[model samples]
Target: MDTTHRKKNEQNNHPRKGITEFDSNRATLRGKNIFPPFYVKTTVPLQEALKNGEVRNNTHLLVIERNAQILALLTQQMNYHHVAQGEIAGEPWMVSL
Candidate 1:
């Protein structure tokens, strides 16, 4: 019997047939809730951010400019969130780090 067919039959007979098998070699985590994407709901002005100590002179930023409008996000914040989304120039935009 073919190995692929044998494996398929084995999976079908298993109780967790519908669930995906984990592959450590490839580091696949199909069902794991790791690194969920973050959504940006609101934004603060640069002055307010500065006043709140959210931004510093040396803080790195990811900036996007479109249709004369600009959007900026802190790199440190993005590092943990992994993904962020916002609107720019009336269009939807997404950024991933």
Candidate 2:
């Protein structure tokens, strides 16, 4: 794969904006407008997320993701605390203490 050509090719390309389906168990909230090459998923409990500041005071969902695509994933959103770990689908939790 040519890195320069690839980068140039994607310079004008744009991802279709939309939320992925959960039925596939690979739901990805597209970051089309802001970060077209990125997406997110969350499955952690809402409170755990708040403690880690993964979501705001009013977030209702946590989207988690697996290791599949070469994409940028934002696990948590916070100023100081970020405790999210890489979680793969159908696999055991990889984080310990």
Candidate 3:
């Protein structure tokens, strides 16, 4: 066999040699967004949210405070989205878990 053909055969015989090859036929969720990003547009007062049972005392929160203003996001919601974005103090921010 030619040198090139011999080298190709050797590579094909090794499991790790073509590890980087991407097989589109085997891609199950290709070009899909499994976890769409979550955005927080409107917010309610913490006290009111608690009163309405929107947030419980034991609920985990990702909190950010600036200029004496506080923004809290539910960690459980963020877990499903994998990413959460919001505007705080006129500045945009994102959190990824």
C-alpha lDDT score of every prediction, in listed order: 0.80, 0.44, 0.86
lDDT of 1: 0.80
User: Residue 92 CA error for candidate 3 (Å)?
Assistant: 0.8
Alpha-carbon TM-score of each model against the true structure? 0.62, 0.21, 0.63
Candidate 3 residue 77 Cα shift, in angstroms, is 0.3
* Residue range 1-97, candidate 2, lDDT tens digits: 6999888677657463343554554566665433222212455555665799876765543344445522222333421223334435544333211
Error of 2 at 72 (Å): 16
Off by over 4 Å in 2: 1-35, 39-45, 60-97
1 against 3, candidate with superior lDDT: 3
State how far residue 36 of model 2 sits from its true place (Å): 1.7
What is the TM-score of candidate 2? 0.21
**lDDT per residue (tens digit) for residues 1-97 in model 1:** 9999999899889975676777577666588557777677788887888889989878899987767877788988888888888676577888888
Models sorted by TM-score, best on top: 3, 1, 2
Candidate ranking under lDDT, highest first, comes to 3, 1, 2
Task: Sum up the clashes in candidate 3.
Answer: 0
Clashing residue pairs in candidate 3, if any?
none
Clashing pairs in 2: 41-63, 41-64, 42-62, 42-63, 42-64, 43-64
Which candidate number would show the highest TM-score if scored against the true structure?
3
